[model samples]
Target: MTISKDSPDVSVIEDRRLSCGVRLLVESNPSVKSAAISWWVPTGTMDDPDGDDADGLAVLCAGMLERGAGGLDSREFNDGLDRLGVIRNISVHDTSTRLSASLRNEELPSTLELLADMVLDPLMPEDGLDPVRSLCLQSIQGLVDQPPELASIRLNHLALPAPFNRSAYGSSQALESATIEDVRTAWRTRCLPEGSIIALAGGIDFDVAADILERRLSEWSGGSKEMPESRPRIGGDEHVEQSGSQVHVEMAFDAPPLCSSDELPFLVATRILGGGSSSRLFDHVREQQGLCYDVHAGYLRRRSGSLCTIGAGTTPERVSRTIESIYEEIDRFGSGGITQDEFDNVMVGLKTRLMMHGESMAARAAAIAADFHDRGTPRTLSQVAREIDELSHRAVDDLVRSHFNSKWASGVARVAVGPSTPFQPRS
Candidate 1:
C-alpha cells in the first residue's frame, strides 16, 4: 500500500483494474480493530430517469441483490454474516448505491469474497419483486408522514433543476412502474468497472484484501469503464403554496463548485449567516424573537454550483416576520460581512470538526473517494485550515452578496407541509 505525503495520516492504495474497470481503494488505519468495506456504484436515482426504470431500477436491484447470493438465501447469508460477526447494510443516495459492512479483521477475506459475489451474481428472483416494490412504495408514503423530511424533499424539488428535483429515493410513481428487467438492466449498465469504487478501510492489510477481491472479481470481469453523467444545476422554476403550520422555506443560489478556490470564502460566509446555532439566523429568529422553533441554515453542493438555505418551523402567522429576519441577516452580512473574531471562531469550529472526522478509517476512505471524484486528490487538513485562516470578512461578504442576491433569492422555493399559509416576503 502506498500513501502520498499529502495525506500521511492515512495510507491509500488505488487499484484501477480490480474488476472489469472497477476501481478499488484500500486504506489502512491501525487505530481501529475493525474493517469497513464499502462499494460505491454510480447508479443513484439521478441516473434513473435516463434509463427505462430511472432511479427505481437501481434501488430494486439493490433490494433483490441482498435477497440471495453465493448459494445462500437472504436469511442464510445474514446468518453467515452474523456468525462471522459482520455488520452488513446497503443504501442508495442521489448519485450512488452503496453496500457496506464492518467486521473483525479476522473475517476480512470471507467478507470481501461474499460481497463481490453478491454485487455480481444476485438471483433477482421473480417472487422477490412484489415485496420490494411494496416496501419502496410504503417508504415513499411514509415520507409524507414526517414533516421535516417531506419539507426538505419538497424544498429540493423546488430548488434544483429537474430531474434531481425528483426524490433521491425514487418517487412512488416511478418505483411502481419499474419492472424487474429494468432493474436488472440498470445494474448491468451503471455498475460497470469505470463508474464503481470499492473502498476498504481499517486494520486489515491491503495485500490480503486486494488478493481476495482480485480473485473473486476476475472471472466476473468483462466490461469497460463509464464516464460519469451530468445532472442539472441549482436555478430553476419556483413554486409555493399556503398549506402548512410552519413555513418551510429553502432558497438556493449558484456558487462555485467544491473544487473552486472561492469555496473557502463562500463556506465561511454561509457559516456566519446560518451555519450553526450560534449563527446570525438562530440568534435573530429563535433567541431574540421567539417566533420560530428551529432556524439555522447551511449549504449543498453540485459539480457546477452550490446552494445556501435557511429553513424554519414557525407558525403561518409569524412566517413573514421570520423570513424578513433571515433576509435582514443576509443583507447585513452582504453589506458589512462578519468580524475577525466571528470568522476566526467559525474557522476554528469547522477545522476542529474536520480533524475529528479523520479518526475514523471509514471517514477517511469515503473522503478520499469523494475527493478523487471531485478534485482528483483530497485536501490535507492543514491546507483546508490555512484557507480558512486566510479568509477575510470582506471576501466572504462579497461571496454572499454575489451568490445570495435577490435575483437568485426570488427564485427561492418553499415546500410547507402542515396547516400554514403561503409565506410572502415584505416589500
Candidate 2:
C-alpha cells in the first residue's frame, strides 16, 4: 500500500481479482481510535429490471445476511457482536448495497471475519421471507406517509424515467409478491465482483488488515458487467396540492452531475443561497420578511444531470410571497452573484465541514472509494482545501453565469404539498 503524493494523510490499499472479482480497499486513519469495515456491492435500485424482481431480491438478501452465517445463528451472531463491541449495520441504496461495522482495534479481526461470512454466506429461511418483505413494504409506506418525502419521490419520478428514477427501496406491497427465486436471481447478478468496492479504515496497521482481508476474501469471484449510464429527464407539470396547514413548496431544475468540474461552484452557490439559517433564503424569507418557516436550496447529484432545488414552507396567505422572494434570491445570485464575504464564508464553512468528516475512519474509507469510483483517483485533503482556497469572487460569478443562468438551467419542477386548495404560482 503506497501513499499517493496527493493524499499522504490517507493510505489506500486495493486488492483486485481475489476469487470473486471483488475489489477490497483499506484506508488507514492512523489517528482514529476505532476502525470501520465497509463492503460495497454496486447493485443498487438503478440495477433493477422491471419484472425481473431484482431490486426487491437484493434488498431481502441484504436483510437476511446477518440472520445467520458461518455456524452462527441469530443469537450467536448477536452475542458475538455485542461481546466484541461492534456497531454492525447494513443499507441498500440507489447505487449499491453496503454492510458496515465499526469496532475497536482489538476486535477488528473477529468482526471482519463475521462480516465476511455474512456477505459470503447467508441462510435465507422461508419463514424469514414474510418479515423482511413486510419491513421493506412498511418502509415504502412510511415514505408515502410523509408528504415531503413522498413529494421528493414523485419529483424523482418526474425527473428521471424508468430504472433511472425508479425507487431504490422498491414500490409498496410489490415486495409481498416477490418469491425466493426473485431474491436469488438478484443476488446472483447484482452482487458480482467487478462492481464491488470494499473499504476499511481504522486504528490498525494497513498491511495486517489487508493481509487478513486478502487471505479471507481471496476466494470470491464474479464476472464484471459494464454499469449502465442514464440521463436525468426533467419534464412535466408543477403542482402544489393542499394537504396541511402550511404550504410545502418544492422546485427542481436540471443541472450537471457530480463528475462535472462545475460541481464545486454549485456547492458553494447552494450554501450561500439556503444551506443554513444564515443563507439568503433563510434571511430573506424567514428572517427579514417572516414569510415562511424554512427555506433552502440544494442540488441532487445523479449519474447524468443533477437537480437544483429550492423549497420553503409558509401559511396559505404567505406561500405566494415566499415563492416570490425565493425566486428573487435565485435571480439575484444568477445576475449580481455573491460577494466575496458570502463566498468565503461558505467555503470556510464547507472546508471546515469537509475536514470534520475525515475524523471517522468509515468516512475516510468511503470518501476514498467514492472519489476513486468517480474520478479514478482520490484527491488529497490539502488539494481539496487548496481548490476551495483558490476559488475567487470572479470565479464564482463566472460559475453562476455558466451553470445557474436561467436558460442553461431548464424547466423548474415545483410541487406544493399542503391543504390550501390548488396552488397557483404568483405572477
Clashes of each: 11, 13
Once superposed on the true structure, which residue ranges of model 2 sit more than 4 Å away at CA?
A: 1-19, 51-55, 229-234, 238-242, 405-412, 420-427
List lDDT for all candidates, in order.
0.68, 0.70
lDDT of 2 at 403: 59
lDDT for 307 (candidate 2): 79
List residue ranges in candidate 1 displaced over 4 A.
1-19, 50-55, 222-244, 379-398, 401-408, 420-427
- Candidate 2 C-alpha lDDT tens digits along 53-87: 44465567777776777777867877888999998
C-alpha-based local distance difference test score of model 1? 0.68
Q: What is the C-alpha RMSD of each candidate to the true structure, in Å?
A: 3.8, 3.6
Candidate with top TM-score is 2
The lowest-lDDT stretch of 10 consecutive residues in candidate 1 is: 1-10
TM-score of each: 0.87, 0.88
